[model samples]
Target chain A: MKRYNVGIVGATGLVGRKILEILVERDFPIQNLFLFASSRSHGKVITCGPYSVSVEGLNDDSFKDKHLDFVLFSAGKEASHHYAPLAAEAGAIVVDNSSCWRMDPDVPLVVAEVNPEDAFKHQGIIANPNCSTIQSVLPLKGILDKYGLDRVSYTTYQAVSGAGIKGIEDLKEQKQAHFPHHIHKNILPHIDAFDEDGYTFEEKKMIEETRKILHLPNLKVTATTVRVPIENTHAIAINASLSKPFELNELETVLEAYQGLQIIKPYPTSEMADGQDDVLIGRIRKDPTLPNSVHIWCVADNIRKGAATNTVQIAELFL
Target chain B: MKRYNVGIVGATGLVGRKILEILVERDFPIQNLFLFASSRSHGKVITCGPYSVSVEGLNDDSFKDKHLDFVLFSAGKEASHHYAPLAAEAGAIVVDNSSCWRMDPDVPLVVAEVNPEDAFKHQGIIANPNCSTIQSVLPLKGILDKYGLDRVSYTTYQAVSGAGIKGIEDLKEQKQAHFPHHIHKNILPHIDAFDEDGYTFEEKKMIEETRKILHLPNLKVTATTVRVPIENTHAIAINASLSKPFELNELETVLEAYQGLQIIKPYPTSEMADGQDDVLIGRIRKDPTLPNSVHIWCVADNIRKGAATNTVQIAELFL
Candidate 1:
């Protein structure tokens, strides 16, 4: 086994820290570990396994001397937009977790299990799908491959953690910070900024990304993303119209055999998916209303399988 | 104004208590108020604005001599099953809040604004739609009456109070007494008991009752109802494919003009809908995936508009 140099940007944020933890847990072959953060987190010492790294603010030459084999960027879109290209130019394979490069025709938007082959086509950068979209497409790929899909409708119950630390704090402290409204005991239909057509940016990410990942540019996709008060994991109610007719039992079996998708019993809940690495799927049933349509309840830890774990898995594709 | 005797069965339960409060808040014309409860709540004295009534255990003779003009039953199905017919046989019109008689052919299931005229045709017992269903059909009716519905899909974020006091306690104490799974800090895709077809009774209620209330027997309806940890209010994400093409602005205007439906600014959430009598509608947008289809986010106080308030409004139809 050959060890490689690994770097993590935004290392102090929620998803960033999870990335660091996952690297250690998976015992990835890492000869050197580098940590980067914003100016406020500079000089913060973080440890993983036998490695202790101090977070450094990104500079023009930050990645120049690193000889980094892989750089995982969990920073927001603005940071990723500024720093990801610089890191990629510095010769590191940047697996960016922001929405900046996802729809870029040159960049491959990858779900580790669903589209590992797409990772090889990356031009120094691989874009990780949105948290909700990552869990959704795993099952969708199975269905699309077997039955074919005509349309996809997503209604998401996203956890506060999807918004990072401040979102969790808002729920715990009962404050109306981070989120636009009180999220302690309330639900918000708005996730990201709204677009001109009334679909939020979060929804557009799911719609566009799903079509791209599935290699179905014309697949009709719509999403209504909502923020719930849960601390971790996300649950998506996926209603999809299949392109072909099939038995319900056959469809369940097909999903059961799909990689990275778990057919959990008694239906999957947010708590059940928390800390898990796989997309836990349950509540598989026919839509009854539409021809060859089905309803799938998909749950996954938004941080693990959705963000950090998927990023790490993308890096693993390199080895 | 003619005042009449009103009876509230299950007077000590959560919805029952809300019914008592709403009646007082609305200053419902009441010559005398009678309270009935299960054996556990017998002898408890509850006070309304100008009346204080002791809860009595339900007996065959409870409504025989009370001369109750209207009886509102919020007890669970078993209690409502045994007592509702008895009360109706005693010449009192029964408006049940349970699922006992919702699909009964002789019973008219009504949303006050959508189908109040059905109340007049009730043989004896009128049924209140399920909490999730009640909030759902308010907007569905608006859409159906305007553009005609081809297919309907519902995804619900129901509050714990829909399960009554025990559900709220389960969330507060982190107990799993009322629900099959832990609901505090968690989300459950399963609500009520599951039928053989994998749909929960709650989902079935939404599907079957929506068709009944809208008087569209052949309508295509599917639902995925989930229980979130919120204490009050329920929000539903409804996706419908309409028979006729609609201009988005024209559809909004039609929904705005619909009675008992409020086109609220920003998107309606559980917090905004709490204690509100009307179904709050928002996030109206075209479903870009399906032709002539649109998405509507509907929210309402599940206990009020969904249960007690709708029950009271149905009684007011006789006025």
Candidate 2:
């Protein structure tokens, strides 16, 4: 196996930390590693496989003259916008985990298992879809290719960690004090920062990223993103009104045939979705209200399929 | 105030215990009180206003020869079907919190604030809509009455308590143990036992009860019920595609004018919903994807508005 010298940008954030954890766990061959964060986090230590690396402030000179194989970017869009091109120009394949370039015509939005071949076609940077979109699409991609998808209507039960460390800390503090209020016992409608259009950034990402990845600009997609107190996985209740009808048994067969997907028939319980790499799917049945429509419940670890695993998978394809 | 003698059936169940809790907290005037449950829970001490009442084994003769004013039944449907009619025949008004009588033409399905007057037309028993349906409709009832609601598409992030004590205990046990698997971290598609039609009992209740309560049999209502690890509140992401267009400011005005709702605009955090009695509405916006559609986020304690408080309020109407 060819060893790659990889660097992780925004190594202090939740997703960034998870990327480091997954790379070590998955035994990704790394020749050397670099950690970059903001100025305040400079000199902080991040332990990867067998190396204790110190974080350095992100700067234009950070990637200027290094022989870098791939750079995994998990910072917010602004940082990715400013740094990803710089890393690419310095001779590194950039696998960005931000929404920055997902909808850009030139960037390939790749889910490794779904579209690993899309990696070779990337001009300089590849975009990882939003965490919610990545998990939902992983199971649907193969099925849609085989059966053809028409319309997708979904609502998400997302964890606070998707917002980064602040979200998880907010929920933790609220839980510890039994703060007259509770984050776990309630649901927050807004997932990310609000925009002028009223849709939270998270909701917009689901819409735009799904359209871009599926190559269905005109696909009928409606989403409502909500943040719950869950810490790991993101769950979705989806009602997909398809263009063609098939028996529930046949649909099950199609979903079961897909690799890296778990068919949690009987009923998809949250317990079933926890700690598993595969997307757990269940509650599969035909919608009684609409012809050719099917309803399914999907759950995946947001930190994995939504971030680290997908990023590492993209990096693996480059190797 | 005229005091009414009340009997609580299924006294040990989740909603049953909540019903007892609210009755004491609200200071409902009671002439005499009786607790009834299955033989398994018979003789269990249940604390009600200033007294620890022993639960009696339920039998056909439990309500016989007694002048009971109201009987709140939170028992399963089979139990409710067998005993509610018996209590009603014994001259007691039954406020059944089961689906058995919800669609019965002779039974009035009531939400006190939404349609208290409907209570006067009840023959012998009244039906309480499903918890998810109750919370969604209470806020919409006044708006629909004033603005005319054409359709609603709602997805619920339901609490485990909706299933009962066992469901709550299952999640708690799963959370306490650090197994190789993560039980509390994922979303569970199944809430209740599956029926012949493949829909969980909870999903069926949302579909049937919402139609009957709204008095719009043909109203376009689609529901995906998911059980999260939360213990109390049931939260919903509601998108109502109306026949008439309404501006965001005007719709906020309509929601603010309602009596039982608390608008948590700016950002509707999950912490805002815990332990609160009022339905928390926020993330209000116009649906940009469709014409004449609006979306809003709603949350309320499932034990209260979903079951107990509604049951107690119905009993209060007769008092």
**Which numbered prediction scores highest in lDDT against the true structure?**
1
Residue range B9-45, candidate 2, lDDT tens digits: 9998888988888888899888788999999988899
Summarize candidate 1's per-residue lDDT along A1-319 as a digit string, tens digits: 9999999999999999999999999999999899999889899899877878999987778898889999999989998998898888889999999999999999999998898999999889999999999999999999988989999999999999999999999999999989989999899999999999999999999999999999999998999999999999999999999998989889989999999999987698788899999999998988888778999999999999999999999999998
Q: Residues A20-119, candidate 2, lDDT per residue (tens digit)?
A: 9888988889998999999899999988669799999999999976788899999989999999999999999999998889988899998877877777
- Cα lDDT of model 1 overall? 0.92
Against the true structure, whose TM-score is highest?
1
Compute each candidate's TM-score over C-alphas: 0.99, 0.88
Candidate 1 residue runs with Cα over 4 Å from true position: none
Q: Quote the positional error of residue B285 for candidate 2 in Å.
A: 2.4
Candidate 2: Cα lDDT at A149 = 78
Q: Candidate 1 falls in which docking quality class?
A: high
| Model 1: share of true interface contacts reproduced | 0.88
* Candidate 1 total steric clashes: 0
Question: What value does the TM-score of chain B take for model 2?
Answer: 0.93
At residue B176, give the lDDT of candidate 1: 87
Question: How good is model 2 by TM-score?
Answer: 0.88
Instruction: Candidate 2: give the clashing pairs.
Output: A270-B186, A270-B188
